[model samples]
Target chain A: MKHLLSASDLTRDDAVSLLDTAAELASVTDRAVKKLPTLRGRTVANLFFEDSTRTRLSFEAAAKRLSADVITFTAKGSSVSKGETLKDTALTLEAMGAQVIVLRHHASGAAQRLAQSGWIEASVINAGDGTHEHPTQALLDAYTLRQHLREGAGDLEGLSVVIVGDILHSRVARSNVALLTTLGARVTLVAPPTLVPVGVQTWPCEVSFDLDEALVGADAVMMLRVQTERMTAAYFPSVHEYSRRYGLDSARAARMPDHAVVLHPGPMNRGMEITAEVADGPRALIVDQVANGVSVRMAVLYHVLSSQEGAP
Target chain B: MSGLANEPAVDRAGEREIVLRDIRLMGDRQAVDIRFADGRIAAIGATAVAEADPQAQILDVAGRIGLPGLVDLHTHLREPGREDAETIETGCQAAALGGYTAVHAMANTQPVADTAGVVEQVWRRGREVGLCDVIPVGAVTIGLSGERLAELAAMAESAARVRVFSDDGICVSDPLLMRRALEYVKAFDGVIAQHAQEPRLTVEAQMNEGALSGELGLTGWPAVAEEAIIARDVLLAEHVRSRLHVCHLSTRGSVEVVRWAKARGIDVTAEVTPHHLMLTEELARSYDPLYKVNPPLRTVDDVHAVREGLADGTIDIVATDHAPHAHEDKDCEWGAGAFGMLGLQTAIGVVAATMVEPGHLTWADVAQRMSVVPARIGRVEGQGRPLAVGEPANMVIIDPDAPWLVSADQMASRSQNTPFVEHTLPASVWATFLRGRPTVLSGALV
Candidate 1:
């Protein structure tokens, strides 16, 4: 309730309520005005230590649409590059009266440290952290899943969601597994054996090495972005081999049930994890995931700010 | 309040003889009085008070367990470089409070302790501090670069008489260099305490590689990184017929490898940190950098295996790899934060909690593991000796039943980065005597 740092922090009831709130907020985006007075006097600071233009703009749009003042601080040209620490940056923003901090850092536990450090008074919303949980991304992905599959009414009960590609380094996959499984969806992680994390058998989901075998009965398939850096790390021998084994092409898409949809937490590798045909196909909810991202972020910012009186 | 400058000397030429009353020696059912004079135990019997000089100071420590003063094989004082984190004086104070009479200061300081000059400077600083004997551990390679050999023989012959050499915080990973370092130290009977992490396997490693690290998303510090190096170094040590001491043996596989090496009659000794014996990788779930350490806290099974290893004499000693970092270093993100936590002040309590209280190790076994064996391994004289007549009066009195809450702000170390801040730990050290000099009295630094 104090912060939306991880998907695992959300319970069944909390996730359902947040999703329901996002559903209500989604209608506002369709309106001509698309403005809400709920966070009119509040301030939301988008603190991106890692460059993610799409995610930054999504959060900025969410805050602006809610009528809250938004300020963006990227690590690229700011004091962060000049040897300023995350604590100092966060404190500076809080001093300037930022009530909520949406952080995206390259370090895994940066957001958690900020929240628990007792350094600042702002409520922390983890936009995304290094290979760690992206709670908002998970929420938006869950929102996207509910809209196409369940008509946006209830939890994803009995929904078989199979997540594909680099589960080891994907914050999206980690967050989605936590949130989707929490929402009663049966999740399966499919990756090349090298791409899969060690000690993943303890996760609440099933695992598969074969993309085809995992795709057959899935209700929703989420493709994670496989970075070029992972290739050099020798996680896979080559792009050709990785794509051949785990990439979702037209043939792999045809293996899934007709009702099943594909989702990607983009910026995607067009030819690597997925093909152009499947990404832009009718069953692909990739664009919808982006649009729903703003709604979910608004619900999060509103929830964090409106429910509390002062510093958490 | 200064760790050294402002303190009055506890040991002086005119110091009076002292009589410790009602103290129970290790494995002893009945308590006895121990009288000290001229930096040696004068008597240890029922009639010690009658035999003592009339000017002797009589102190009552009823029912307290008395043992040879603890000696740490590995410690990071952070002095001669980063005094903002810790100095020899404060580190020794913390050591005295933790019941350690002597500590082998690790060689990872800035301007790294690789030469005779640096090691002598560190050794001299410990002498000036006059708290605990700070035996400087010489670096195996020049500046710990893992390439060429350091001035190991010169450091050994220096005033520090450094017998334990290490490239701690950076492994001497090159096998040829490792073999050469291991073989070269044999001349001075020196032991190489290797920081057993394979550098490549732990490039960006943040925590122990397992289910927890997979869940936390911090890069995995796989157990193989530690085990592989230990296995390699032990074989290399056996081949060269040199002594090899594994620093902070963390994983269960590492323990198995050490057991195998010992069974194979390899001249290999291993030491486990106090934090490793108790804390596990589960603490990484909080994402707090306080639990962050090198050879990252392993799983519960690894903990049990190390405990069993220590109990069975496979792990030779309990060393407090008490690495201290400044507040700025640990107050940030887990990955960006510095590795290591304060251990000098909490070693005994952690050992008691994880080993003794659980019935795995006896008080006699504790003396052997924490004090006797560590002194022998480091080749320290006048320490790890019996608390008997004609023996050097290096000893500690521990109240086994007294459990105290750990607070970072109260520690004598310059930095407050202890992971055990709020923990109520067992077995408090009431007093620590270094050669008849009281460095810690009534649980406070003297």
Candidate 2:
């Protein structure tokens, strides 16, 4: 793919190929020398307009592992804070001979604009935009899912996935719903009516307000973090109320089918969206998702930058 | 008025008496000849009168359909402020090119038009341009701050004779202020046009609240934000037994509310903009700020609902809400950009495409919605009159079959921020006459 701006931009074949490539790249992490010469002599710039240490570090590690020279520019303590625009920053990066730009912006469509705006010729990858898609996160989640549920099957057809909590503001939920559905997973979103956007009916997944009902036949249950900042504005009544209704506590986690896995795109609220017991439980794959994030990002950078069309 | 340094001086010294021969009047199949002299329609008949006045100019317009000049109840001529975006002269030229003879200048300008002096200056500027009538809409609030009411009585009685009062860019959200404004306008028989967006409900809203917005990650502007305000305002207007006009009704729920209010015998009138009737929130998918507007473009279902509302008379007229902004305002990121688009030049073509072509409204209905009803709402005199003998000769000759693609570079407006650019639209204004003077002749501004 020329760019990874949205998870919806990936087709079934493209998603699977990226997952398989990530699986192959994951092996390098176990080796003494965890470096590949695939992107040697190439440069990838991480242009972050938002504060995202985890995503930025993951991208940096992924590029270094692939042997690509990396440069990171955070919005804070830079020209970005002095009102330099995305265009100016991108043009400056282009002048410095950067071939690929990984962007995590606060605005929803910053990555899309960076790619289509003709400001620079570099391939753009969206790290995470404002409540928008995080394609790499979805890919890593898919990779982690494939490693467990459909190990060596190379596809995730007929798997049922239930995503619960704060679907309205979760970029992870938006990306996972799109990417997982593309891989033939039947996805159901469970959230409070206020936590769901007005037009959730139009999404591909079935929606339910009841978390227990959605957890019954699910192959995987993904818990999204509930931002407490949104709580002050009355998105929900209180943290306690939200936790009581949607939190994946041990009681609700036990209700899931024995083989069903629990996933949380992390920095999880230990007692909020998920209980400490459930989050530390055997079914939880939060740690694995983070580790796979590096491999998946490497695969994306390799595909987008190593291809002849994307190559400078 | 001297502050209008960039205003184009219109030279009307050479305006001549004209005769249009064999022009098809709207809703009539047979062609007729129309003669104009002394700023009035001297004659209109099947055959041209044998006038011996050698100075009269006669043009043979065989197939063009003539309708009363369009009147826009909503237009933003950013004068007395923000002249870099648009001035009264340029905005009038755009209106003339779009077949509009009169437009109510919105109150949301720099130095908000809340007083008699500002409205009079804007009105005089329109008169100086001589392209179209520019009636200044008085701000319902002091500075459109939704605080104290403006000088509605003074503005209504001033030289500008403002008949429509509005706080268009911002809603007069305070219920007491809205009620007082509605009640105060009743003394002068003025209508209070509401912008109808509850601020709290749409704090950081960037686009329509839907699946696309969720996926795109733009802040969702729920339809209830617009509907709830409209619902409350209509009741306020009803309680006071005063006239209320809803500006740019964009959602299906808002339509249902307006329809309900009208059915209850309340004196409420709502207008849908050309953009709301045709464009949808899907256009925001491209992240282009040109599609950004107040009361953000809704879904396809809302577009159809607004169109149906207009067709069924639940909506009274089609207003352009012709907001103009400079390049810097629209060329930035979608969230940082201003909320508006160029509409004065493309209003008629969009109305024709969305309303007339689909059989939702006949050509005669187009005249009523685009001209007569808007004129009535704004209380504009000598404009949007019937194309009959002795009426003021404010009319437009349209070639409905003529199709043209929109190009912002070629538009007369100062700003090239129209979302309709590159869109092939049906209908074209062949000629526009404002009181016997041709402001637009042969589809070009005079």
Candidate 3:
């Protein structure tokens, strides 16, 4: 794998191999050395055209653990805002010996454009893009799910997952829907009519407006962040009304099966998408999802860089 | 209107008279000879062969199809602003190579061609270039702001004599403004060509709204946004009893609405771009801005509907919508890239590949839809005339058997943003004549 741009680009075997490698790499974090020589001579560049502190730090830590040199470039307080194009930034990174570029931009298809534009020879990893796939995020989420539900085995065959809230604008939901279904999991997306996309029926998942009903038979529930701007955009009437319907409070969590776990991709709105009690509860894997993120990214960087080294 | 000179001053002295031998006119089984004198077709068939001037140039077309030159109802020359993308001279050169005799320049320049000064400048530049006749389209709203109407009467009476008015890049979404513009143009026998898009619905629309858009994570441009405006404008035209033209109609629902309006005799004409006829929304998978355009490329089903619409006369003409953008504007990410493609150089080739070769339209229908009907709708005079005695010799000779590849490097336009690059099309424009003077001959610019 030269680039991890979209979760949908992964085959079933490709996804399983990444997960298994991530699981093996997770053990290295427990060791005192906590380092690998796989990417010792490589350089990884985190090119964040948008403000994403958590994701950039996670990738930075991952590259350090793999013994790869890291260079960080952010759009804030930089020449990018003063009219430096994405092409110029990418070329600069490549000139500085960046073998892999982890890009997070505010525009959809920005990562794909970097990868396919023939402007640079670096492999592109999409940390996140505007309403587009974040393949590594989905990978770490899948790795966390396998650790909790599948006992770190093969695919999550026959497992059911319910993803709730803003499916229309959530890149997390888009990537998860593609990656989870490819692993033989049945995924159901629950959101308001206005929050769901017009073509959600074509996705390989069942869609429901009622979060309570969708949680009944689910083995896991992933809560997506609901931006306050959506309220003013008329996607929903009010935050109170949206919470009353889709929020996974203590009451809504009891509706799920006893074995069902809860997951939320970081920096959560405590009282909005999920209640405070539910986020801090024992069943929630939000904290573990972050820790697993580093390991999964290490696996991705190692895979893409080492595979290219063996090429003629 | 600008006056037409009976005898066009030819750049090359003593080359005004010529004899075209073995040219195949549409609907004729055998080839015939045509003689031109003093910028007009002097004779055809037997008389043309008998009265051939000894000093006139004699060229054999080898039975290639000859028809009146194609007329474009929509083109963006980008002069008066954005000359970095294209100029009147470069655009007219591209048009001549594409088998076009005239093109209606769109009104969305830098200062916006809303007044007599801007429109007249564009017209005069084309006249000075002397390649293809460039007719300036006046903006309905000043600066294309979609607010107050521009000086339509002054522009109509100017040296440009604009007959088509449009704020093409930005739709006149205001219903009252559209109605007023449609009614106001009636005094000058003008048509309001509308770019039908609802602003609120398509805030940042990137691609066609469908399953692919959801999967690709790009913003969806719903078909209803286009159909709703077209539906409302057709009703407005009906209420005012005025002529309306829909520019670059790109949806199946839009085709149905235009068909219904035509059935009701609302005096509306619709045009489909060659890109919409051949390309689809699936190209968005590449995330290349070359395929990105306003009224975005739709599904295969919409392609079939537009083709059927063109075949059955429900759609009136095939306008190029030949928009050119500079490298910086189009070579960036998809969202940041400009929404346009070079079309003036590849119009006939795309038409032949998509319409004629598919059996959706014949050579006769091609001439009507590309030339005669567009001229009639835009009220362009002395062009799109039938090829016969005393008619202006503004026509194109095309070789249907010889197919050529579309390479952006070979195009005359200043921009290399054509979506048809590297595509092998079915027809080739061999030669184009503007008032008996060759602008392009032997597939090269004269």
Model 3: lDDT to the true structure:
0.91
Instruction: List runs of model 3 lying over 4 Å from the truth.
Output: A310-312, B1-15
Off by over 4 Å in 1: A310-312, B1-13
Native-referenced DockQ of model 2:
0.60
Error of 3 at A88 (Å): 1.3
Sorting all predicted structures by DockQ, with the top scorer first, yields 1, 3, 2
lDDT of 1 at A82: 90
For candidate 3, give the DockQ. 0.80
C-alpha lDDT of residue A26 in model 3 = 89
Error of 3 at B112 (Å): 1.0
lDDT of 3 by residue, A187-263 (tens): 99999999888788989999998888889889999999987788789888889999999998999898789989999
**What clash count does candidate 2 reach?**
0
Candidate number achieving the greatest DockQ relative to the actual structure = 1
C-alpha lDDT score of every prediction, in listed order: 0.90, 0.88, 0.91
Chain A TM-scores, one per candidate?
Answer: 0.98, 0.97, 0.98
Please report how far candidate 2 places residue B62 from its true position, in Å: 2.3
Candidate 2 docking class: medium
Candidate 2 per-residue C-alpha lDDT over A1-312 given as tens digits, one digit per residue, 9 for 90 to 100: 778899999999999999989989999999999998889889999999888888999999999999999988998999988988888898898788788999998888888878887778888999988888888999999998999999844778999999998888889999998999999999999999988877788889999999888888899999998877877978888899899999999999998889999999877899999999999999999898889999999999989986745364
Kindly report which residue pairs in candidate 3 clash with one another. Answer: none
